[model samples]
Every structure is written in C-alpha cells, then in structure tokens.
Target: MRSKHPPARAAEAGNSTTRQGAASPGVQFLTVPADLAGQRIDNFLQSRLKGVPRSRIYRILRKGEVRVNKGRVKAEYKLQPGDVVRVPPIRTAEQAPAPVAGDQLRQLVEASILYDANGLLVINKPAGLAVHGGSGVRLGLIEVLRQMFPESQFLELVHRLDRDTSGAIMVARKRAVLTHVQGDLRAGRLEKSYLALAVGKWPRGRRLVEAPLRKNTLKSGERMVSVDPEGKPSETRFQVLERFRGATLLAAEPVTGRTHQIRVHAQFVGCPLAGDSKYATDEANRAFREVGLKRLFLHSSVVGCSLPGGQEVRVEAPLSEELESVLAELRSGTGVPLQP
Candidate 1:
C-alpha cells in the first residue's frame, strides 16, 4: 500500500474538470489513459462528470453529443489507450464535496480484510455499506478503498452484494485478476454460500430450487425481483442448518447469478428471509426486529474460487455480533415466534 495519489490527466489540449451548476465554457477532448482501457464509455463519463446525473449522461450518449475517436459510439463501447474522447459542454447540479471516510470507518474497513494475495483482495463487507457510490450514496466501499490505498492503479469490485447484505466480497487490485475471476463467476465456477434466517420452517425434502427471476423497477426507482416464467433461469440449493420454533436457519447457495435470486426464491417457497423488507412480509420483519435483528438476515458466509495462477482460495466471514445474538436468542427459545 503506497500513498501516491491517482495519476494526473494527459489531454491533447485543455484540461477537464467536472463543472457544477453550469455548462463548461467549451468542449474538451481527452486522450484515454492506459489504466482506463477496457472501461465502458458511459462509466468513464460517470467518473469524469461527478455531479452530472446518470440520465443526463445517457441522454448525451443517445444524442451523439459524446464521441470516441471523433466518431459516435454507443455507451457500451470500451475505451482503448490513446483514443481521443470528445466531450461537449455539460451542466450538472450543484453538489457538495464528496464525503471522506471517518477514522472509525477507516479502522473498521481495515480490520475487515479477509484475504489479500495475488492481486485479489477480499473483505468481510459490512451491512448497510454500498459497494460503490451511486443512488445518493456519497461514499461507498470502493471509494473508501481508493482513498485509503491511493497508489493502486486499478481497483474494482469483482461482483456486487446488495447494500444490506454483509459478506465475503472480492475486490480486484488488477485488471487481469478482475477478468479472470469474473470469467469464473460467469461460468459458475465461483462458489458462494450464504447464511439466511428464513421466516418459517423449511421442508427437509426441498433441497434444490429452480426458479426463473424477473427484475422490475418501480416508479420510485426501487428495484424488485420476482419469480416469473419468462424470466432468466435461476437455481439455488438450500440445506437446513437449524430449526427453530417458527423460523429456520438455512445455508443457501445460488447456482445462478440473478438479481435478488435468493430472496425471491425464498419467498416463492413461502419462507422469505427474515428482515428482508423488499421480499419478506411485514409481520415477519417486525417479529425479527423485535428479537434484535436490525438488518437483512442474509450473510455471504463463504466464497471460494480459483485464481489465475491456479491458486485455490476459500474465505468465510463469521456473522456479526448482532446477528449472532439474534440467533442465540432464537436457539434459546426466548424470541417471539414468527409465523409463516
């Protein structure tokens, strides 16, 4: 971990800065750097135009106001080194300075590191922490990491976990490592297992669930997923870990990487996750909250994958103290019995 800052820009002419609350005086042409190669154009714009809204960025792309190598390109176009990007004058909303991680948060993040070797870094990501900054979040795990380790040229999330889901999440320190691990993830070679507290007694016979999941966005911009026949194929294997009076602790392994697959599938089987506000019943959430469960009772307990150098890595994150306490109460028969 070196303390050097991010590399400076190398533009053909005028420098680029994220103008806020007003349009730039003139268009700017920027030469893509080697470190940014293979990144999508839209994502590049998002990084360049900090205060600009995502909708406005897409609108600029759709109308061909932004060009790559003096030619119109789609948002998905990957940037190559030395490609000149033409950016038009754009206005953005006035935004406050980006938030910096406090001392406490910095310590917490430092202490949560689970694995770091061969360009792969894993952390026991805390619940309520977003993986990346977006959707009104000023500072996320990735942003904090960049701030902490400024010398790292490339650091990106290999996969995403919901903001409320805590677990062993991977962060790639190099692009090559990211590409290799993500290839494994797409091929179903990366193994992930979660520990979930479901709302009802799980049937012993139901070990595997094959369901298709469809994602829908509400007008409020909230994302929701449900089981649908026309949705993408999904599968999850469930093994009953422990039985409670009205709740069951389950070890869930998703065979397919679908949005909200586990939560939606659990609901489909009439055993939605406890404290899952998006998919579980209010009654169940209320009961679990009363028993000291403040966050979604889902934890990425285990993550196992092979590195590019044929190294095997398996990491497990223990449950947080609050979660462990809730489980202890359930096992002691002291918590309120939840109903299906």
Candidate 2:
C-alpha cells in the first residue's frame, strides 16, 4: 500500500549518541529514497552498512539503537519514502578489507554470461558455488562479481539458486530494475525452467505437483523441507525429457519459489534427485557417483521475462559437459524410455 502522506525525511542532529541527545561520534541520519521504499528495515541497513553482520544489525534494532521517524520500529517494518532513519554508532574494523583478486572466478563467470542489458545480468552459475558468501564460505559469486566490476555502484541478486544447482541466475544492476523484476516474479510473469535427473523412471505426460512445503531445522542444524498441511503453498510442474535404465531426465519448473522445492517435490513423488547429497538415497547416490556424477544433477535451464519496455527476453544455459557426459553413458545402458 502506498502512503498518501509526504515521503518520510530524516533530520540528523550532529553527534547525537542515541535517538535522544548525547555526544556520539558515529551517529547519523538519512532519508529513505522513494526507490528504497517498501524494503525491510534490516535489509536497508544491510545495504547501507555493507560490512556489518546481520546479527549485529538485529541486535541494534532490538536495543532501540535504530529508529525511524523518531520512533523505534520492528525489523520487518517497511520503509516509506521520505522516512527519516536514525542510524546509531556502529563499531567497524579499523583496517579496510584486503583487496580481492577475483580474476579467475570473474573470467569463469564472464564466460558463462547468457544475457546482459537494461540493468539486468543473467549468468549461468557454475555448480558448487554459493550465490552469496557466508556460513564458512569465504567468498561467493556475488562477491566475485563486485570485484569483477569495480565501477558498478550497485549490484544485487534478484533471486537465488541453490549452491549446487547450476544455471541461469539473475543479477540486478540497479534498484529500479531489481524492483521491477521482483514484482514480475511475484506476479508470475517471470518463468524459469530447470533440468534434473532423478532416480527411477518418470511417468509420461505433464505432471504438476501442488504440495505445500514446510521448512524444518533439525537438532544438528541441518535445514530440510517436507510436505506439511500447515506449510506454505508450493507448486512444481514436471515433464519427462528422457529415460534411462534406472533414472529419468526431467524438466522441472517451480511455480512458487520455495527452498528446495524441486528436490523435495521429486522426493515426494518417490524419485529423489540423482547425486543429491541432502535429499537422495545414499545407495542411489553411491551408484550415480560410481558412474562419475560428482554434483547434483540439476541445472537451471531457461528463464523468460518481459521488460518494462515491452520487450520479451529469454535466456538459456545448456547442460554442463560433465552432466551431459553422464547422460550419454546412461542412455547407452540397458534402460529404455517408457512407451506412451
């Protein structure tokens, strides 16, 4: 909902320690831009304070170190244009981060570029690379892109791909483009297709799975998803692309994005993905691994969307050589496609 009132604007009193008056060195205030409106408070803070940990930001928010319009707001509060934001003094590393030399990774990603225009970049992300760095990962694809293009003032991920799933991933070069693409995604205007090899033969004809998924974190801190009545709604469409002796190649398209939707859905149908470390059967995985499959046999194959200028853009990424080789071996084996 758009606010009819004037855009929120912030006025900073010089050196105020807190929202109230006290001498503080790092206190500052900023007005939210119209383009930045509707974003969560914590997200805004993360973007503004590039190096700050998300946990620290939430801590400050809990302690009332941050305020908007002279009042404290929850982390989920959406920013309205012209809203004044009071940023409390934050402790940062005294030494600047060492410069990253991302030449090798940058070249690899550059070679994987499928589309770049109108403030959007589409890249065929390589397998085994996290989209963004954290959780024991030193650097990720986004960090490498930042170093790859030093002059780019802004770059953000519009959506995410799992660490092991390789294929088309969107990168927004501008805030407006990010907003536009995200809106399209929410409205189902953007379409994405992924290719996967799942254990067992896939049944013929178009299949749609409308199963709700609930996320669960186990005692060991492993995250998993399952079909639960109380879970959020989820949907995935599947078409059998090929069949092998004991495996099937499938075209999987998720209508609603959820964590591990495709993998979980495949499991729901009793055919977990081949080479899936987290979700596949250990015996099946070992069999596939013995045959030379190293990573999850899933790839983001294609993406389609309409631009603000009425132009339709579609991008595609072919299967990686490693995966294709495995498919060829599977085809030559004893299994055959099921007859219609």
Candidate 3:
C-alpha cells in the first residue's frame, strides 16, 4: 500500500494525469490497477500523499473529501481494481533524504533471512527496530529493505512486531501474496507463537487467559492497553518453558491479536514480562537489567500460514544471542533446573 503507483502495474488515469497539478492545487482522480486491488484506501493515501499527517487523512475521509468511483468511501474501504479514486488537493512538505541504515542493522538484517521464496520474505526481525518509518523513526526495517533493493517494484510488511520484540516477521514481495496472507490473518488462520521471559516463577502447567483489553492514551501521548470489561475479547495461552529462581521462560500463543495482548495478559497473571517498561514495575525491570537484560524479553519465535496454492509455510527464529547470554547468566547464578 505504500507505493505511489499500483503495486507492480501502471495505473490508469481518470480525466487527469497521474501527478495532476501536484505543484498547483486541484482535485485529481486515479484509477486503481489490478496489483493494488486489495489495499485499504487510507493506507493508499498515506503512500500516495507524502508528508500528509495520518489525522488529516482520516479527517478527509470523514468529511467526504475523498471518494471512490464518484462516491464517498470509508478509510478502511479496500480499493477495487478499476475503481476511480478522487483525491483532493493538499499541500505537502518537500521530500527529505532517506535515512541510512547502520552497519550493525545492515548485517543483522542481511543475516536474518529465514525464508525467501514464492514472493514471500520471512525474516528473523531484529529487536529495537520499527517495522515501518513513523513517529520519529526515519529508517525502519521495511525502509531499509526498500533501500537495499532499490530496483524492486513492491515490498510491504504483512504484520507488525513491537520495536523491542525480535522474531519471525513476514514481508511480501508480490501484491497478490500480500493480499492472500492478509486474508489468512483476518480469518485467524495464521498461527504465531512467542517466547517471553516473565518476572516471577511461572506456575506449573498450561495457563489460558481470556480477558477484554482496552487501549488508552496517556497525557504524554503514549499508548497503553489494559484489561477492561468493555474492551475487545483477547486470549492467550502460556506454557512454562523453563524456570529460574525468580523468573520463568514461557511460550505464549495469542488466539486474538490485540494491542499488547500478551504483555497485558502477562501482567494480569502477576508475572509481567521482564524488561517491559510499559507494563512491568520499574523495580522488576531494574532487577532484570542488572542481570544483563537491556530490552523487553519478548520474541516472536514461530509463525505458520498457508499460501494461495495451499502450500504451508512455517518459520522459527531462535532466541537471540544477547537474550541467550542473559539466560545463561541467570541459570548459572541460580543453578535452577530447566523446568520445575
């Protein structure tokens, strides 16, 4: 969706040039091509209209300033092939130079490819990197990939991971693949699992958490998710993987994808994720950091999904070396068995 042109094909114009009066001011109509058929209208605008704030895009949609096939369309409307979209004229900032990726990030991304075939790229995404550029992050993983492959026609993230979470994440090289995978995700056919280090000893046996979570924005503009009765239903399954003196390693699989679902559920169980700054106590985070953990101890370890042709894809990412080092130190210090 973050492409000026329809993913990989040339888009037709509707009584206007593709870049109709971009330097001036006037409405322009664009015809969607087959390659961009399933992209959401809001996302399409975000890509086409550079330097426009997301809030403005939503406002335009709400005000009926944006239209599809001569009729007003919602922000979430999926653009259909051959649909003519009416885009209002708006001022935009001058384009800035793209940010350069650091050597460490380049090397890590280059080495993290777990699967690449049939228009899909599965990566063992590194921790501390945003998936897409925004919110002061100029060079995210996707931007880096685009820079790395300048000649490529299209590439987009299939899903998102938190900035501090490292693990298997998917990127689509083909628009069709992106559409298919997204459908699978929406249908809950895609399965994902994560490895997390919790603050306290985990109880023996499997645990299932089914809670409703609501998102809240703080005065500082920071976003948080908490368990609320009026919120959306969320579910997570946690299995104790290994135990330490005052900490536990767990395998967490989420049935419903909500913002910070696993972290909130972990906190609800009185075992907030180690090094989770938003949910865990400062004292607990400080303790874990003192023991050599510097980032959130959550990682997307496994992902499974089927492609359009019924070919299944399952990828796994091992615990990072930095995390492994911390686990080793903890194990040696406590001399605890792997499991209870």
Candidate 4:
C-alpha cells in the first residue's frame, strides 16, 4: 500500500493529519465493467474497496462520496455496465487500516495454505478464527495472509466464511482476478456448502430454509439474527445424512450468504444446532456444551468457484476432529444418561 502524506493543502488539516482512513482523498475513479452491471451500489463498494470493512460501505454511500455517472445513487440502486463511478478521497488512515494481528495469529494463518495456483490462493482456515480483523477481534486469518504474501500484490478475499466457521477460503492473487471472481459470486454462479449437526430427532428428508434475517443486537452488544420480513432474504438447502440418539447430522447448503443466517434459521425451524450457544435453547445448549460443545458447531466444509482460467476449483475442509469427538460424546451420553 502506498503511503502518501496528504499534501499540506487547505483540506481540513485535522482530517488529513492522521496517516490513515479510507479511499485516499487523492480521489480515484472506478469504471463498472460489463459483466458487473446491475449490481447494487453497496455490494459494488464491498467488492471494489480494497481494505474497507463491508459494514462501512453503506456509511460511505450516505456520505455522497460514491457517485454513479456523475450523480449520487441509492444504496439499493442497480449499477449498469460502463457506469463511471467516482470514489472520493478519504483519510487513508481512518477507514481501511492495515493489519494489527499479533505475531502468533499471523503465523498460524500464513501456514494454513492448501494450494496456490496462478492469481488464486487457497487456505484451510481453522475453526475459532475470524477471516479478518473486526469487532474487537485482534487477529483474523486475512491479516496473516497479507503479512506472508505481501509480494502477491493486490491480494483480496473473494468471500468470507464466518468468524467461528472454519473451512477453505479462496484469495485472489491479483486485483483483476479478485474483481472477476466477485462478479461470478454476485451473479449466483458460485457455490459453497457447510457440514453441521442439529439436535432433536429431525424428520428424515431434505428440507429447504427460506428465512429472512434481520440483525438484532443484545444488551451485551453481541449481535444476533432473527426471522423478520423486514430483514434480508436468505436461503439454505439442508439434507439429513445421519441420525444420532437425539440429533441428526446434516449437510447444510447456503444458497444466499447472510450473517448468522444458517445458525438462526436452523433453530427457527425447531432444531437448534447441537453446540450453538448463541441461538440454541438453554437445555440444548447446556447439555451439549457439557459434553465438550464449547464453540458453535458449524464448519464451512467446501468452497467452489470458477477461476479466471475458466477452470472450476472445489476444495473441502473437514470438520475439526475435536468437534467430531464432542458429537460422539453427546450422542453416547444421551443413552447412558450420565449424571450432571
């Protein structure tokens, strides 16, 4: 990343004093390509902004810094191909800052590479790790990825797995590749699936989840998801694969990506995942947690996408052995009736 000490200009000295923020007010222009036309403004920024957080993209839109074809567009406005977009200069020091991950976390993320081909890098992210730094999380997987692959200039994430969800993550080795892959994802041409276990004898069969997700913040500041029409639409197609004593192991395929969409929707349908402490009921959560179900029982098991070379790549990361063992214990304990 280039470090340009703002030219000591009449622009607010206090604003430019900080060595960081988002889009350097030095101002840059982005041309919407033909394939990516008709995408939403916020989604467009989410893909285009290099390091800025996705949550903050809407904030920039409200600031009028993102203009489409010389006019401000709504966050929901669909962008047309070849639309000229102006990305106003921001104090680089404030918005999309550099990685602040500690040494240990950085080392772990760098060493988890599964493969690297051309302008695409593959990583097997472990559970209990965040993909990027956020929400007071000091170290995320991407922080280390950047530290180790600095020479791979223009590195960026094609998609996010989740904070606690572990699995194969794909990174773009080059900027053009990043944008191209994102085009495929936004067009509903990309596919990713997860493996999970749900509690309480679910009906044997495949089920489709059509849940609208809305963010609801708890008093403790922890955010959660709930079913609300006002919320964003989310879908997950699930099929029961195995049945435990009181649980059914299933394969979850999320059709639409939404925060906490899978976990919340699964619970809403009457079967909370075995170890989900956040949305699971007290009895189910406590009973499972006692048997070593400490973290959320969700793993992004597979990632599939089309590369710039026109080749399809699919990678799978099995669930952690520890989580699997915990599931075994939970199933066995139900029959033995272990004392609390």
Candidate 5:
C-alpha cells in the first residue's frame, strides 16, 4: 500500500482513473510462499527483507497486518513453514477514513457541497475520528451523519480515514456513485494528498522510501509494518517543508496504498509520527501528549478529481487545532513543549 494516482486523472471513472467512491477500492490478493511456511512470522520477514528492517517488521506483526493459516494470527506463533501469509489491503488515507463530527463537521458538509445530485455528496473530511465505527470509537463521522441527516434515504461512506486522519471524503447519497467510485479506486484512478508532522530530522531535500510491505501480526491481534522483499511493494515520497526539534513537517505522497505507509515509512527511516503511540517510542508519545498533542499528527489537506460530465471537484481542510498548537510550540521554541 503506497500511493494513489495523481490529481488530474483522479476522477475519471467510466474507466480512466478517479473512479473512487463509486465502489469499494479495488484490491489484488496474494498469499506468501509455503516454502518459508514453518518460520516464525517475524523471523521470516526479517530474513526475507535483507536490507529492509526489523522494527517495522515487528510493528507490522503487532497490527495483525500479517496473517498465518489464512486468517489473522500472532507473530510469535511458529509457522508450519508452508502456512500461507495473507497480505491484506493496506489502508492509505482511504482506509477507515471516517468523517468528522461536531458543529464544525456539519458546517463542512453544508459548505463544501461540490455537487449533491442524485445522492453523491463529496466534502472534505477532517483529521481524527473514523469514517466508520470500531473498537474504542463510538461516535464517528458516519454516526454523527445519521444524527443530522436521519431521514435521508442513503448516507454511506465510499471509504475511510484512520482515527487521526482527515481530508476529501466521498459519501454516496445513492448507490450509483458509491458503486462507481469504489470501482474507480480499484482501477487505480483517484488519488489523495496529505500533510503530516513527522518525528526527527529529514534529509536535505525530497526523499522517497519504496519498499515491499508485509504486515506482521503479533499476539492479541496487534499489527505493525515493515519493508520487506517478501512483502508487497509500497512507496512513499516526502518533501521536507519545515524542521523542528526532533520533528519535521512534511507533505507526504504515498505511491502505493499501504497501512500506515507514511507512518511506517517514516518510522522505517527513523522518524515516526511525533504524536503517534502505535509506532513511536513511549517517550516521544508521552512528550508530545504533554504538549496538548492529544491526537495523531497527520492531516488530509486536499482532495480533487475529474468527474463525469467534465466536472472537476476539489476540497481542502486545515489541520486540527491540536496539531497546530504543537507546531506553534515548535515554531515559538517553547520550553520542551507540553503534552496532553
């Protein structure tokens, strides 16, 4: 899971790219080899990825990104060597990309109603809060939607956002746009862009991390990511915009769609998301939390595409105040920024 396509061709579904939200994102499923079947999940990935890495490998394991026996399994468990490792579709910004709720969220829907004909509602989604429901998340973007638009005939998500991510989200008022958009994403047409706060310093200029990603599953269904040859191909490009103490503000463009591709790739290169608890060290998480960084430090800044009928739609949203505050602290050179 690396990147989505470019901006111009983002919306041309009746087969030329930009077809996301018309249907579920397209996916190709393949299983790991049985020859390396009996090895431990982590060990196998580590060996296969020679120049890749171990921390990322182990992290993928914890996320249950990697599978054994054709289903989700732990990393510590010994593989029978031939056990099939199922690599699930990694979520780019489109993954679990739930919408935002609150007075502000409603305002966005009403304000950015690009084209609301026949049940297709395209609006910018804010970072944080999921598009759908999941563990530890009760009220999500869609849930709040039902509260306000209760009588609407159809209000379903075309995709998702990580709990901390935000950006262009597509909603299907009717089933037609939903079906078409999903089909388009599958065909690799629609694309998305994101702005994130990364941990640590970066190279002097634009950099790219391209690696095959394999999700490693650990006990209790924890999933982590890593760069491995035995894993599916994943790529990420970064442009360092600003550098702060122990962190960098970057505009990351993922080439292949993968779970935490930006996060994982950043961490793989020694720069996890500053406020991320899933991949960063406990100290960093604690430090950022003290500075009012209560949420993930990623934001989906813009989304656009060419639609049928020669319509081009683009939506943009700002980063959350929480993240903004932290950036301000970094910018102001505050005394060891406070945490949440």
Candidate 6:
C-alpha cells in the first residue's frame, strides 16, 4: 500500500507569510487572522498560496495533508479566528509569473469605478475581462486590482459576472464588508438586474420562469447549463423593455443565483440570448453577427444592496458603445429582420 503522506522534501520549516512568488520548500504553519474568520478553508489556502495551483490545493486537502488546529479538515471547513493551519511543502515558482497590467488598462479600470465607499468598491467591469485568473487566463480583474492597490491588505470579489457580460461588480475592501454583502445576496436582499437582447421578440407581459438547472460538462471540458428536474431550483423574472424587428431588449432579474440562470432560462422560454455562441442556434448567432453584434448581448445593468454600516447603495453601468451601436442600427431598420 502507498503511504498516505506526501514525499518529504528537505527544507526549513517556518511560519507562512502572505508574500507572493515561490512557495516555501518546507512545511508552513499559518495562524488564521480574525478578519479571515468564516472563510472557507479552500479559499483561505488559495489566498495564502498565491502561486500554487488550485488543483494542488484541493488534492492536499483531500489527502488529509492540510490540518487546522492539528486536525484534518475538509476543504469546505470554515476557518475561525486563531486557528493554526499546517501546509505541506510544494514547489510553486515553476509556474510563470502573472501578467502585468498596462498603464492604459489601469487607467480604464480606474475610470470605470462607480462606487468607492463604506468598504465597498464597485466598477463597471468591461466585457472580455475575466473576474479572476484561471484556465488559460493569466491575469484577471482581481489580480489587476491587487497590482493597482498594493497598499491595501485585502480586496475580494463580492460576486462574479461572466467574462462576456459587462456591468456593475462589487469588490469588498474589508472582510466584514464581504461577509455582509454576500449575506445580503444569499438572503435575497440584494437586487441585481441585467439587460439582455433575446433572439426572438419576447411576449408582452412580464414572465417568471421557475426552471431547475443542471450543469453539464462536455467531452471537450466545456461547462453548460440546461433545464432538468433533478437539478437545483432556479428562477428568473424577465420583462420586455423594447421590441425590435428581430430581437427583444429585456430586463432579467435572477431570483435564484444559479450559474447561467438568466441565459438558460431565456432559452427555456424559446428566446435564446443574441450572440450567445454556446446556447443560441448558429443561424440566430449568424443573423445577429450580421447586424453588428460582436459579443454576447448581456450586460449587468444594476446592483442594489445595503452595506455593512446600514447605508444603501444602488450602482448602474451604462451599455458599452458597441452594444449601444448595435441597438442604434436596429432602430434604424437598416438590415433585414431575422425570421421568428
């Protein structure tokens, strides 16, 4: 039988620090800070082991190599104040360094800020930028923000938007703020609305879709969501905002925060989103492409929530120039309308 422990590597043992770059060669012991209390163990490890791959971190946790207060804990274990964590040695410097953010990108991000108060930072995140680095993406908004504000000790995403979806996203500068905002989201106290262009003209009345969604992984490792009875319960409320010759502009509010809830729900109602390569029919996508649609026609238009200090905030992001231009063309009736 194989030994359960990882192979011993020769190095000095010491307390771990938050510095990025190479992982320590020896086993490291870390004390959980009060601010980090209630964070999941896996997330905590990822934050501390900046250069380590997420897979490696999960593997360590599965093999019982990671211990909290000298006891093996699951990855979902919530960290507590004063908890001591033990981490095994692993090489991390072998990975390439994260990509640097250019000056232009920095300025764009700074200019996109919509709200910066009460421990919350909101930005009108541009399309094509991932929220965090993973897969083939070397750097994302979180990493860029880290580079931008090196003096800040903590900055974490309150929620996520798809890479192709441009809109209001919140980042918490303090742990308490993260907890409070996320709590509101879970309790349905936060209101989030998106603007979407559907391939077909939607029905006139507001509709509430109560469809359960199941996530599937294709043979090529792509993730997709579809309606299934056995899946998690999902709900989306949609209202028609405008009707075009070939498409409908709508406001979508997700009552249940399932992955791709709005996109999949729209498809379930016989109106797939325009420019959605993964979910929409090729002919529909081609038709939209012909009319100046370059990317997914989805935007996070609004987010409203109460802050930790009881102050309410409502943030909105205007449609991008490209999206606005697409609408303008549709309004002009320049191209042939798509067949229903």
154-221 per-residue lDDT for model 4 (tens digits): 56667887777777888877755776777788888877778887877766564998989998889997
TM-score of each model, paired residue for residue: 0.82, 0.83, 0.84, 0.74, 0.61, 0.87
C-alpha RMSD in Å of predicted model 2 compared with the true structure: 5.9
Tell how far residue 259 is off in model 6, in angstroms.
Answer: 1.1
- lDDT of predicted model 6: 0.83
Superposition error at 103 for model 1 (Å): 1.3
RMSD of 1: 6.3
Tens digits of per-residue lDDT, candidate 6, 94-142, equal 4445578999989989988999998999999999999877656667888
Error of 1 at 207 (Å): 1.9
- Residue pairs clashing, model 6: none
* Superior by lDDT: candidate 2 or candidate 5: 2
Give the per-residue lDDT digits (tens) of candidate 2, residues 46-103. 6666555555677789898888887999987878887788777665542124236467
Q: What is the lDDT of candidate 3?
A: 0.81
- Cα distance off (Å), candidate 2, residue 82: 4.1
> Top model by TM-score, which number?
6
After superposition, the stretches of candidate 1 with alpha carbons farther than 4 Å from their true spots are 1-43, 47-88, 92-96
Error at 210, model 5, angstroms: 0.9
Model 2 pairs whose backbones collide: 7-82, 8-81, 8-82, 8-83, 9-82, 10-84, 245-335
- Candidate 3 per-residue lDDT, tens place, 1-340, comes to 1324432343464224323224524566678878888888876776676555556677789899887876998977988888878777675443344567887888889899899888899999889888877665677888788777778777888888988899999998888889999899888889899999998777666499999999999999689999999999999999998888779999999988898999999999888998899999888887787778899999999998888777899999998998998899888865322222
The Cα error of candidate 6 at residue 205, in Å, is 3.4
